[model samples]
Target: MAIDPRGTDLKRLLSEDQGGPVVMLNLLRFDDGGREMYDQYAEALSTTFLPRYGGEVIYAGEGSTALVAEAGQEWDAVLLVRYPSRSAFSSMVADPEYQQVTGLRTKALTEAVLQVTTPWE
Candidate 1:
């Protein structure tokens, strides 16, 4: 859905300017967790974290079904949030409401990768 389908457009946008903090989260499982995992993140991010910081919940939910990989596979659910800054995200995670959801999410997923990346300057 771009001039290039290989994230070239995204990388180009990053190259030009990707101000502030962007976090990419990958939720993975062995086909066992059911719908609870997705539910928890949605609830927590929507009800708890997003409102607290005045930040943007850029993206969320299960990955695209259009593309499937040959070797392995994409994550079960993905989250892309843009916090005001790195510290805002850190503080939000430590906040009481967000902290409470950690237990729910912990029980929901078998594996996950929370990656924080600064866009290219």
Candidate 2:
């Protein structure tokens, strides 16, 4: 039921940083009528905040039939977003303007998984 990251979560995320670019994998489950609200948030994020923080969406799409998964494990959507670094991601979340619109994202999701990824050589 936790939609957004907390200060402790951010701290832990940053503490695990390896000082390199990071791609975040977002698995999202929307509440009823939540996708529309998330769409609005995504627009603002993609247009304003992402560019400002040197971040970009690598991929985003609605979730499809699961080829292999446990019951109740399917997501509504998935997003892959890249940031210059973990710190950059943290900064964007900390931005005052970003904070203004953060509620939209929080309200839109019933569940979410935000995980950081590193590239393989």
Candidate 3:
């Protein structure tokens, strides 16, 4: 049910920084008619904020046929976003301009998960 990160969550995310690029795993589930709004958000994000902050969408796809998962674990879509570093991601989220457009994402999702992943050694 949590769509956005709270202050505490942000603090924890930064604290866990491993001092390198980070790939964020986004598991998204949309409410009724939410996908369209999310698409608007994605358009703005990809064109504006991402380039400004050294972030990029590595992959994005609609979820289908979960081979294995708990009853409530299926997602509607998944996104993999890479940031130059944790600080860059933090900065992007903190930007006032980006904040203005965040509502699109907020309004689009019923539930979401944003997890940071480190590259495999």
Model 1 poorest ten-residue lDDT run: 1-10
Task: Tell me the TM-score of model 2.
Answer: 0.97
lDDT of 2: 0.95
Where does model 1 exceed 4 Å of error?
Answer: 1-19, 64-73
What lDDT score belongs to each candidate, Candidate 1 first? Answer: 0.59, 0.95, 0.94
Which segments of candidate 3 are over 4 A away from where they belong? none
Judging by lDDT against the true structure, name the best candidate.
2
For 1-121, candidate 1 gives per-residue lDDT tens digits of 1111124433444464435766554445423764566586667777768778755767766666736576455666676777766556555665787766666666666566655566676
lDDT of 3 at 41: 96
Candidate 1: count the clashes. Answer: 0
TM-score of each: 0.65, 0.97, 0.97
| lDDT (tens digit, per residue) of candidate 3 on 4-120 | 887788899899988999999999999999999999999999999999999999999999998899998999999999999998999999999999999999999999999999999
lDDT for 12 (candidate 3): 92
**Candidate 2 lDDT, tens digit per residue, 27-51?**
9999999999999999999999999
